[model samples]
Target: MARTLVIDAHPDATSLCAALVDRYAAGAREAGAEVEVIVLRDLAFDVHLRRGLRADQPLEPDLVRAQGALIAADHVVVVAPVWWGSVPALLKGFLDRTLERGWAYRYRSNGLPQGLLAGRSARVIVTTDSPGWWLRGLMGDSAVRQLTRSTLRFCGLKPVRATRIGVVHGSTPERRESWLRKVSDLGRSDARRTPDAGKAMPAPREIASDAAV
Candidate 1:
């Protein structure tokens, strides 16, 4: 059976991001994939990477379990909100502390970084208050790119897909429901696919929202 890990990066347990996480996990479970969820808000780890990569920092108990989950998962889904053209500090700090050198990646003799977590796939779902066009055109989709490319892919998660649901500040309940269904479908589809280690990373897929700016 496929093992999927869903990470909810929102600081609030009651946020919309948490709802999306719930829907996704539900779908994955319904599809027969074993699903595990990591809610960053509930984890007891400090958000600060006080010691940089140069020094050895001890992992908190929660972080240690999170690492084991990542290692075991065939697919990873991250749900977060875009804050100031980037991801929240909570999510960023989780990555900083978790995907450390020698664990997620290591430098080669040629000075190139080798990813240790190859063969895993990922999906990033981001909720934003900005319109899709404004985020894609003006803001340059920085948040999604940061998570999908600079972070997940850097750690060797392949073919990472992205979904952007937004204009959320003024969105109606109907639109929100549609986004939840879409995400659930994504989870179902992802649960059926096995990660192909040789496949090249494709461009991130954008799931547009209907809410007007």
Candidate 2:
């Protein structure tokens, strides 16, 4: 069975992201996949790297364990809202600490970085009130590319993909339902991917199924 690690960045366990986690976990479980989850808000950590790898901020116990979890999972899911067009502080800090050079990646003699976290897949789920068009056109998904390509995939996780749920301020009932189905579908599909093929995994909404949320 595939093993999956879900990093929940939302502060509230009762949030929509948590709902998706529940949905995906359920789907993967039914598909015989083993799943583990880390809720960032609940995990104690320092968001600032402080020395930026010079002195190097010490890893929080939670971060250390979270890194270990990442090392063990076949798939990694990062769920959070976009604060100021980027990831939440909790999630960013988790990455900063957990993905230390020697652990998650390494700089090669040629100046290229080798992704140590190879053989794993990754997904980024972003919740926002920004208009989808505005984000897609103006932002160019800079954050997702940074996290997925320049970061996660850079560290070896394959097929990294980003999904955005926009206009969160007040979505229509139908829209909300659509998003729910989106989550459930993603869960089902994640259940089936090659344990390590996160190479641009499609967002749950993009992988729609007939099932109701």
Clash totals in order: 0, 9
RMSD for each of the candidates: 9.9, 9.9
Error of 1 at 144 (Å): 0.8
Please give, for residues 171-203, the per-residue lDDT of candidate 2 as tens digits: 787877688778767866877874544343322
Name the top TM-score candidate.
Answer: 1
lDDT of 1 by residue, 143-204 (tens): 99999988889888898999998878988899999999998998888898854234343332
In model 2, what lDDT does residue 195 have?
58
What's the lDDT for residue 91 in model 2? 75
Q: Which stretches of candidate 1 lie over 4 Å from their true place?
A: 195-213
Instruction: Report the Cα lDDT for residue 69, model 1.
Output: 82
